[model samples]
Target chain A: MTTTDLAQSPAIPRDGDGPVFREPWEAAAFAMAVRLHERGLFTWKEWAATLSEEIAAAQDRGDPDHGDTYYRHWLAALERLVAAKGAVGPAEMTARRDAWDRAVRATPHGQPILLANDPRSCAHRP
Target chain B: MGAHHDHDHDHEERWSEVELRVKALESLLTEKGLVDPAALEVLIQTYETKVGPRNGAQVVARAWSDPAYKARLLEDATAAIAELGFTGRQGEDMVVVENTEAVHNLVVCTLCSCYPWPVLGLPPAWYKAAPYRARAVREPRAVLAEFGVAVPEEREVRVWDSTAELRYLVLPQRPPGTEGLDEGALAELVTRDSMIGVGEPLPPAGAAA
Candidate 1:
């Protein structure tokens, strides 16, 4: 999916007041939260409650790295809210993830390879 | 998705060949008992989740939103990035390149994927392998073209060769039409590939509406 689609989707709070991410996508999620709140899509209180539930579920699953655990929960929460809001559908997102997974599996070491030079592909130019 | 299935098949074939070579090496090392499977698993997890992409993201975001910060980034990327609270092993030294209209920068550690993990979270899969490193420097424009990134012939493309000691990340220019955006909002526009200079920060969909 396009970055725009990802951005317009609802904010997914990472579990609790856990460690803020050091990466851009994590920051993007945070930014979305702020934007969503400003627009009144959801209040900070609702966000907190949803996130707490997510963290609790992760704890039940016996995941370690409490803070990191929350982050994943936060991503999940956002994915759910965004899908509910119709910014994007779960099926489409799953398809994208599946495509990425396929690419990873096909690579020699189960890694993803950058394909920037296929002659028949219009996306590839010199 | 089916439209790309044929291309995917080709990728799968190439990947299988490469995987075999890597598995062979890993198997040899495992047989020698040089690397414990459990320890290897932990190491991979630590690097992927904790060290790599997270670090890279902070650096790219700062460069996008802060002019003075960007200057500091290019001047002393390692220390500047560390200021965001990410540092230590695998990070080492880092160089930040600014992408401008007259010039564009792309980084590839052709020898191997020697990236600044403290700044960028994890090196994307394609980055750590051979084809990208070998081809990026030699035919960067061609490589970027595949990512749907176009560069004018007039603009000079400067490809940085990464080394074990020094790692590089691109600081793509902030997209137009995002005036008056807060730092956080601007940061949202920055993506992994944009930070690598292979793509532009996409415009916010709401902005058009």
Candidate 2:
């Protein structure tokens, strides 16, 4: 098969005009979703549908819908979809989120943000 | 940058609310079996190594050398960029505005962080910070000043605010006395900040050295 065909068996995301990220994390999120889709974790259609739902829910909850913090919704949908797939428990996800919050709290500025070992141990880092 | 940075001393509190949340998700995903770290690294490396500011630099460098491509870039940036194989999410649509003797262009995403991904991989920290989001649209000249970009009195400064569907990348004017520099060297002079219009390209070799 042609390289382009293999690349597009799952169509690659096309960036709109301008730069793709306002922040580094947006690229990280964007990359994560693409990687997950490439692994057949979820189809792009599934991702789009779930993301639209998440955006709608946010708007319902008074998200100005200006596209500010849109990736927040993207992350939420990702979390929900991964949870739904049973790859990881939702409660476990929340606990990890807390761990990250704590990690950030403890990390001095300019140092790398690393999760504490306890949860990493519990979660089975490998 | 100096005054504001000094004012905000509790640097540990710097991770924005969204950054913290996203990091947590990444951590959880890696810690769990939901996502593969190696696959994630492939994606990250794709952007870091294969696609990013270098690609943007190549585009700018080509435009500097080829006027026809530059015209196409401005007229249909998306199509032109795709011709160079720089196409994907965050770069699905693009507008390449030129910085000329009479005009200077600056890019911002006041609403959210919308940028051209195929060219500039990820926006730097300051580009995504609250201060830039709040200040860019209100006072374009002052923001440029903070970045050390001086648009002379005769030239007008225009700020392009990006959204989900559209993004803008500034094509900085080629530096003077570089008629001898080849395209590769020209691309080397194209910095990420210059493409974003926050700063200018480096001086020519003799002048630079």
Q: Give the winner by TM-score.
A: 2
Q: Write the per-residue lDDT of candidate 2 for residues B1-209, one digit (tens) a residue.
A: 22344444465544676676667777777766656667776777676666779899999999999999999999999999888888886787799999999899999876445678789887665665445665677667666776778789889989998876679999999999889999999999998889989889988778854
lDDT of 1 at A26: 46
Q: Name the 10 consecutive residues with the lowest summed lDDT in model 2 chain B.
A: B1-10
Instruction: Kindly list the per-residue Cα lDDT of model 1 for residues A17-63, writing each as its tens digit.
Output: 13334443444443344344445666544555565555556556764
Cα lDDT of model 1 by residue, B1-209, tens digit: 33555553444344333233233323333444444445555544565456544456556766667778888988998888888887754466778888889999998766434566666654554554345655677678767876778999999999998765677878887777777777667677776777677777768657662
Stretches of candidate 1 above 4 Å error? A1-126, B1-42, B52-54
Count of clashes, each model: 18, 25
What is candidate 2's DockQ? Answer: 0.15
Residue A82 in model 1: lDDT: 51
